[model samples]
Target: MSFIQTLNDAWSRTQSLLCVGLDPEPAKFPAALNGRPDAIFEFCKTIVDATAPYASSFKPQIAYFAAHRAEDQLEALIAHIHEKHAGIPVILDAKRGDIGSTAEQYAKEAFERYKADAVTVNPYMGFDSIEPYLAHEGKGVIVLCRTSNAGGSDLQFLSTSDGKPLYQVVAQLAAQKWNDNGQLGLVVGATFPKEIETVRGIVGDMPLLIPGIGAQGGDVEATVRAGRTANGAGMLINSSRAIIYAGKGDDYAQAAAEAAKKTRDTINQYR
Candidate 1:
């Protein structure tokens, strides 16, 4: 099955838009996992198992592993998700943006090496920077548009000759031009619900990966009302620190599960 098909199945099977984000920060790991060489994988695998019932997707940010030289653990965690939580799409949140062979290698890293179902990419360098990822048939290529940070306005809000913000232009291009293979999706932050609504209008039913809900304080009601498809599904709402770090004790996995369940239930209430 294709990435989108698998994602659709996940939404139906789990009745969720929640995309659990695995951004492991060792400094914040629980006491039980401290000093373990495989702490990153162990912590994340435990959380994945505990919360798999409520999540429609899992996004593991690559930088979290690379910074600690834990790429092997990252690979193991993704493999474990595939093995134990079938149908739940794992998105490698690498946000890679390069051109030519470099971009191809990045694509290889995300699709072949990491074995992620989907991967996020930056659109700053235009179509050529994104084309290589599209070469990997059926793999999801999510483009960054209208990011959640306040500093994003420095560039995203700047008006182009079309009198629309740069972000909107990116949305138009991604929807009409870049999505020929139907493998494209957009990352529109949950913090910007109005922009999310606007992007949804431009992209129609294209799936959106929305971050900023939990630790970022994005309003769930506003995010759902703005981003959901007409049928009330078209989002992979992500929450990282808020869900994964819900507890710091031995029962951290259980705490993460409860947090994920509450978040999934709250999102459903609005949907």
Candidate 2:
């Protein structure tokens, strides 16, 4: 199936819009697993096993694995998720962007090497940097639009000559010109609900991968109110630290599972 079809199927099968971020920091691992070369993988495996039932998708931020030189572990985790929970999609959050040959290699890394169903791409270099990823049939390329970080306003919110924010211009371009494959999506932070609503209007039914909900203080109800499509299923609300680090003890996996369930249900309530 195509990336969009796979994602929609996962959402329907799980009845969830929650995308658990498998960003394992070595420092945050449980005491027993901390400092181990394989701690990140072990922690993520347990978290995925526990939270898969409540998740529509899993997003593994590549930096966490790359920082520790755990590429093998990252590959293993994706394989494990595919093996055990075939219905759920895996999005590799690499945010890669470059020109020409480099862009092709990044696409190869995300879709061929790591075998992710989707990837987050940086759009600063414009369409050519994004086209390689889109060239891969059935793989998704999610462009970074209005990010959640405090510094995102530095560039994204700048007013263009037409009185439109840079991000709004990006939204218009992405929706109109770059989505030929029908696998395009935007990363709009949940922290910016009004922005989410505006981007939603621009993109129509295209999916939005929203972060900053949990630990970052983004309001869940506000996110749902602004991000959801008319059918109430166009957004994937992500929570990382809040769910994964809910506990530091032996029951960490259980705590993460409970947190995932609560988040999924909370999102459902507003839907």
Candidate 3:
């Protein structure tokens, strides 16, 4: 199956668009796992075991593992998620993009080396930066359209002399013109619901990777109302620290599951 099909299939099974972000910040880990690499793996294992049932898929932010020089350890974490959740997709949230040859190597590392089912890439480098990822059959290449940050407006909303904002231009390309292969997805901020609707209009039925639901203080209710299609599908609302660090103690995994359930149930209400 292709990446879109795989993610949609998972959505069907879970009845959810919730993508739990397993960003294991060392500072937020349980006291037991504070400085231990093995503890980080164990914590991820516990959280995956606890929250997999409620999640449509899992997104492990690459930076968290990279910060600790624990890239190899991430394989173990992904393996654990697969073992426990079976077909649930794993999206490596690296937000990578580069020019030409460098892009190919990055795609190779993301898909072959890491074996992630999906990855987030930046579109600023143009289609050449994303073309390398299209070779991975059934893998997702999500382009960063509008990110979730206060400073995001710095470039994303800049108006061209042509009158369209920069991100709208990105949406037009990522949705209609640039998707030579069907493996494309777009990243839009949940914090910006009106922008979500605007981009949704541009993308049609393409799956959207929505960040900033929990930790970044995005309004979940508003995002769901705007980002959902007629059937309220095709959107993955991601929550990381809000879910993972809910308790920050021994019951952290359980807290994470509860947080995921709250998010899922809340979105289901609008669905």
Off by over 4 Å in 1: none
lDDT by residue for model 2 over 1-271, one digit each (tens)?
A: 8888997888888999999998888887879895677888899999999999999999999999999899999999999999999989999999999996799999999989899999999889999999989889999889999999999999999999999999999999999999998989999998899999999999998889999999999999999999998878988889999999998999999999999999999999998
Give me candidate 1's TM-score against the actual structure.
0.99
Clashes of 3: 0
lDDT of 1 by residue, 1-271 (tens): 7777887888999999999999999889988888999999999999999999989999999999999999999999999999998889999999999986799999999999999999999999999999999899879999999999999899999999979999999999999999988899999998899999999999998999999999998999999999999889999999999999999998898899999999999999999
Model 2 regions more than 4 Å off: none
User: In order, what lDDT does every prediction score?
Assistant: 0.94, 0.93, 0.88
Q: Least lDDT summed over 10 consecutive residues: which range in candidate 2?
A: 28-37
Residue pairs with backbone overlap in model 3: none
Q: For residues 61-167, could you state the per-residue lDDT of candidate 3 as single tens digits? A: 98898988888888888877777788899999999989879988988888888888989999988988888898778889999989989888999999978899999
Candidate 3 scores a C-alpha RMSD against the true structure in Å of 1.1
Clash totals, every prediction: 0, 0, 0
